[model samples]
Target: MKYVILIHSNPDPWGHPTSRYTAEGRALSEEQHEQGDRAFDALLEEISASGELVTGEALADPASSTVHTWTPEGHLATDGPYAETKEQLAGFFLIDCASRQRAEELAAQFAGPGSVVELRPAMWSGGDDQ
Candidate 1:
């Protein structure tokens, strides 16, 4: 009944919105910022009303990503993420759902104009929190 919706970006696209933020684009102008706050409020209200959002967040840029892979040898460190192509995981949502269909319906509403959210059931270990 719980799922993680991984948001992915299209790599081949030249003007991907996720790729739009640069050093100069970090902070928006006053009007732009006001609009952003308004949008955030509306989005939060939508999520709360839907009953599909448990907790979610917009992630920091992928450039800040740190990768650690382990093998028999030990651990391997890398810069950024491990996306095969340009597409990368931008963010995610942890949700409790009644059915897969309902989850998918919720995903469709959340994706917006040019994004995809992959939903997968989560596995939590059964043990006392240490």
Candidate 2:
């Protein structure tokens, strides 16, 4: 089975992976940062070695995102996400797992404090023809 894991968290707490703000933002202690990094690395290694990791990527800050809506007239573009929420999608992992339980386990491990991981099965895959 295939699953997409959506990673959500407050950007203020950790910023983007490449962000330079460590103190002005929701600053995590140095130790917390190191531990989180190690855990994430370990999880990725485990999944890759198990041949479950199809692909993964971390997203840019939500501030850079755009939302589009369709009106009776035409499409309209807007700034930011479609909804306002404390947690923004930070990243995602696409994995081929043996079962939902396995996928849930991976998602649980991927999610950290104040973060959420959502595992959803793809309704239609890229290669599938309707």
Candidate 3:
């Protein structure tokens, strides 16, 4: 089974590895932050060695995003994200794992203190659904 772990966090003061130093992340102590970093790195190493990690990437700040919509007249383009919310899609990890339970377990560890992690089964585009 293939699963995608979507990472959501506040876009302000953009930071990597699940926004450990951003908005809500500020509530945690430096030691806690370091622990989270170490844990994340270990998880990545474990998954990669097990051949479960397919790919992962961190997105740029939401301010750099562009929204495009189709209007009756033509196309409308605007700067910034499509949604006006505190949390936005920050990054994602695509993993090909054994089962849903295993994927969920991995997602639990991937989730940071101040970030929201969403795990969903990935669908194939070519009419071959799993």
Candidate 4:
């Protein structure tokens, strides 16, 4: 089975979870920052070594995002993000696993103090050679 892990968080100066910029996220010292970085790196390495990581990436700032829609008159374009919320979609990981339980286990590592990780199965678009 193939799964996609969606990461979400509020816009942070240093970045979500890592909180490299904010004093609170820094936890009053550089030690917290380094530890957070290592934890994330370790998670990636663990998944990669297990051969479950297909691909993953962090997204750019949400303010730079754009939205498009069709109106009765014509097509419309607008600045995004379209949703109003404290948290926003930040990134994702694509993984191939043997079962949903396995995928869930992998996604658990990404759940942090200020971040949310969502696991969803990838669906085929049809017209496949299979």
Top-lDDT structure, candidate number? 3
lDDT of 2 by residue, 33-125 (tens): 677788878899999999999999988778788998899999999998765886788888899999889998898887666667888885675
For residues 1-130, write the lDDT of model 3, one tens digit per residue. Answer: 8999999887357777555656667778889888878888899999999999999999988888999999999999999887788888999999999889999999998777678899988997774354
lDDT of each: 0.64, 0.77, 0.85, 0.77
The candidate maximizing TM-score is 3
TM-score rank order: 3, 4, 2, 1
- Candidate 4 lDDT tens digits, 11-122: 4663644354334454545676677679989988988998989998888777888989999999998998877986788889999999888898889887665667899888
Instruction: Estimate the lDDT of model 1.
Output: 0.64
Q: Is candidate 1 or candidate 4 better by lDDT?
A: 4
lDDT of 1 by residue, 23-89 (tens): 2224446576466557656766776787867898767656668889998999988987676665567
lDDT of 1 at 22: 28
- By summed lDDT, the worst window of 10 consecutive residues in model 3 runs over 11-20
Question: Candidate 2: where is the Cα deviation over 4 Å?
Answer: 18-28, 125-130
> What local lDDT does model 3 show for residue 99?
89
lDDT measured at residue 15 in model 1 versus the true structure, 0 to 100:
37
List the candidate numbers ranked by lDDT, top first.
3, 4, 2, 1
Q: Is 3 or 4 the stronger prediction by lDDT?
A: 3
- Global fold similarity of model 3 (TM-score): 0.89
